[model samples]
Target: MNSTTDDTYAIAIVGGVYRERCMRPAWQEVYGSAGRAASAMASMGVSVELYTYYDSITEPVLISRAAIEGFKFSGESIPKSIIFDYDHGLATPRIYSFGSRQSSLRVQAEQVLRFGMLEGSATVHGKRVVYDPQSPAKPEPFRQNGSTADELALILNYREARLLSGGVSTSADLIAKSLVLDGHAQVVVIKCGPLGALVHDGKSTDLVPAYRSRSVWKIGSGDNFAAHFALRWMEEGKSAAESADLASRATAYYCQSKGFAIPEIFESFTPEAIVPSEAFRNGRRPVVYLAGPFFTLAQLWIVEQARKDLTDMGLEVFSPYHDVGCGSAEDVVMLDLAGIERADIIFAIGDGMDSGTIYEIGYARAKVKPVIVYCENESQENKKMMQGSSCLMCDDYVSAIYHAVWTACSL
Candidate 1:
């Protein structure tokens, strides 16, 4: 444990390190939460110390080590090691852990960071700690020995706050109050995804909007938000609102780049740079809306494949089947219409007689939106409609998506 002087600015990340397998865009292995945050902070000229378990005997641990080594921060400081072996599999927002150990380590620094339950029951006391309850499914309870009232707790969404309060309250004030009442934290931050985040400092709560990004690969966005907020609040002496705003910008940058390095423009970013209208607005890029029948397994799988292919082509996508699940009938209609309205182009799979998808195509055409229809087996009536509406019809899915991208860019 290192004692901090009044002017010392150092950060210590105490969590479990693992390898992430991204299914979107492509299947590739990358660094998990802890490693990503450490590298992100280090790239911003902050000295970071990582406390995690790593053993060469375990293949996952070895992979995690290799991933960390590939980052620029691997040579910044000597990482402390713990002797627990575990395999962490990250499937987007969800983490699958096997052989995870639950042991505590004494982390000494001005600020301490913890993400999920996989970090174990490490007791952090008498320090400015920042904790993120990673998932609502498996929430991490706060446990500590000594008393310190200056801590920040970050939640993925408002629903996850129930795990901390043991009650059913979604209000940011109530959640923050519940955490403070339970002696869990003094400050609480709830990340509302595209809607931005809410920060409560036990006195007042503020809502911070997320910045607009050109592309969004939402795997490690929360980790980047926590890392930036901790550094700005603890080291830079920024207010909670200011810290949350900066963190949102940093997260937007991460989501757009989907890389480890932070952009130099974010060093002096301002609130004026944010879109201010919507959190997930498109930035100088074409937005493609995917409309198809997602009722069956095969249909849903095809839609997902098309989404990934379009995403890889550097275009923003609005997949109603993936984004809007089997909700209420009214809710589904409203959500899908909003997505369609924001899109510059619509991609429809017209192979089968899907009434909902056909209606979507009609609505998009009515709005003067370009339509790209793909149907291997189409009827005469369907072909007549496709030709009448000036849609590019193709029998192949790949060719249809490529044509959609080209058509969208040309528009």
Candidate 2:
């Protein structure tokens, strides 16, 4: 008899429960995918059971938190992660992971209980399955061909989908459809950072937009989406698109509150839908103008990282330092101005209030290019003119990058 048939729990979440520590914006809490998802569903009034491995020292703490999350948990004592997430929320965190299941151990679904790289025909026998292959940036799971469930909803982040699809597809829609078209899943969802998600049900493919929340901490957001989707699509039997939209909304709530205490009436919440830049609709990506002073090592690091990060995120970036290396004032100014003219938006580092950066900000403003300034240690008086000019001044580094990308694209 499959344990899934019992009403003791609405869904079983099989994953890790790490002692997570995130910085940059300064967050001091601990939750792995399993704990985060279980907590999310439980808060939404769904009966959730978590099965996983945990550190013996934190077993008592896990039990106490599980009780508060309104879920039951059972797992073996094993070395777990003390993850330290950095300033880059979207990137992989530094994890001290411990598990000796080195050689891949195959497991038959037998009725759904999971996490780890244990890949096989492991979804529930007859139940609708919502599976997310990657957990925060855990080890890549061993690939096995073909999967089956009463209904399958396979969710993967951008990198995982690209890797799974062999990095051949140009777009998320293509990647998701390829997975479905091939037999990896009946329904596939590729999570694109700001562009939202691309969902492909064997028959049709669609782009579901991510909702805008006041604050965005991307650590366990994917886990929240997986949980919400599992509830709406698997338990309640909602349409794939509708379930994804609802899940996106719920994820926004998680980002907004930075916790898993989702309300039962979360559906009633309406968040602003992220609108991609008009150029994106036409398949043209907006160019980002990187404007900042790189006088010292720290300054140079930000400039370099911002350019690399933006470029890796699939944006056409024009960095003055990299593009126009050490040069005379005349040629550099001429080329820099031209680059700004070619760009749709600008990201300016206002730290130290460098004259050149301030000049670029003013130039961007005059050119009507959308500007996002990252200024952490500036006085309000110095920001008066920039603020009056309607520049989007952000104090946070990661947030500024995100703002620049989204702002540029939407322009």
Candidate 3:
């Protein structure tokens, strides 16, 4: 048997095998999986220790253990924290090997057995376990066939607490409820994007509405919720029921706000722990400029596609062709130039490298407003002009459009 005086609960955070890609390494490496969970727990005044394991994607060999023990053996440490066991199919043997050979399944089974053994030991020893059964892949409406293989494995079978996190849409909420009804968890906290969370303990479910706010940027909102809720639950010694309510409110507060500042209630929950709604933060909308020739239908199509994509990422786009009418070349150039100067970032189509497009590129460069060039196909003249400009030369319009949106948002 393993033992220690650290006195903090060992929390594990799993899931996000695919989401790790969409986010920058800075988001993961700096705000690590374990670190984010710990941060959430800390907000509730809970001292915790966190453990994180990435799904699939083989890692380097390390020491193996047979005994199911606590952090004393695992070497993880934190205060009383929420354990985030993200339910990626990567953890189970049969699921991981669904499309592969039985040999791979055998290896996965051994790993799960070891994990279960260790986890069982930890529970038997003494530690409050909270499991976050979320994944990067969006949960589909429980397809009998698609989720069949996943169901047989029972990946989330052992969680005492379930956190509905990471892209929690309506479909995800239903799945979270099913997990609870199925006995995979004793309590369920459903993270409802702007609305808040729905928390359910075996007997009852409560809809905890979010604290209202003005500004919003939902980049790492789920991570923020997991951190604050976990901390508040552990530190305050609140019941799972109370924790669910608090977590929902915390997530809403963070999502409605901006920046990564840790909330104060996490350290010590006093009567004042529940703060006013206006305490949340805000963000300024980004300004965008779309420049290109207005003659060709193909070029017009590319511009429209770019507009749609940029709008999706939350930008106030300024395109003269759309705002004004797609008129003569001279009129479009004049309007495009004016829009370019007022904008923070410029995405110009270099399909033809028309004199106007070339002039706009030079103008954007002169203003230092980050110009991104999009070419429909390989044109020597277009390629030469795009060389020094912050551009993406692609074989087709779709690629160019995607590159432009990505580049513009990055800046």
The best candidate by lDDT is 2
Lowest lDDT block of 10, candidate 1: 70-79
- Say which prediction, candidate 1 or candidate 3, comes out ahead on TM-score: 1
Error of 1 at 76 (Å): 19
Candidate 1 RMSD to the real structure: 9.7
Per-residue lDDT of 1-411 in model 3, one digit per residue for the tens? Answer: 122324344333322211221111122122333334444444443444433332222111101110111121122222212222222111111121122111110111100101121111121112333433334233222222121111111222112212222323334345556766665445556554222455665566665544433323334455665554444443445655566556555654554443433446323422112221221112234567877767778677667767876665456788877876766777665766778877877777776667767787788888877776666455676477567564545543333443444344444
lDDT (10s digit) by residue, model 1, range 9-80: 377665555555543344344345666677788777776766555434333543564355432222111133
lDDT of 2 by residue, 1-411 (tens): 123334577677766676766667777665777778888888888887776556766688779988776888775555554455565675556756454542222223323423433311122343466677764344243234223465567788887888777776877888888877776677787888678888888888778998877666777888889888888887777878888988999988887777764564575678889898766766677899899888899899889889887887768999999898767898799899999999988888898989988999999899887898889899999999999999998887766777777776677
Question: TM per model?
Answer: 0.63, 0.88, 0.39
Local error of candidate 1 at residue 82 (angstroms): 14
Greater-TM-score candidate between 1 and 2: 2
Clashes of 3: 22
Q: Give residue 145's error in model 2 in angstroms.
A: 9.8
Q: Which one wins by TM-score: 2 or 3?
A: 2
Alpha-carbon local distance difference test for all models: 0.66, 0.74, 0.43
> Which ranges of candidate 2 are over 4 A from the true structure?
1-6, 80-84, 102-126, 135-148, 166-168, 264-268
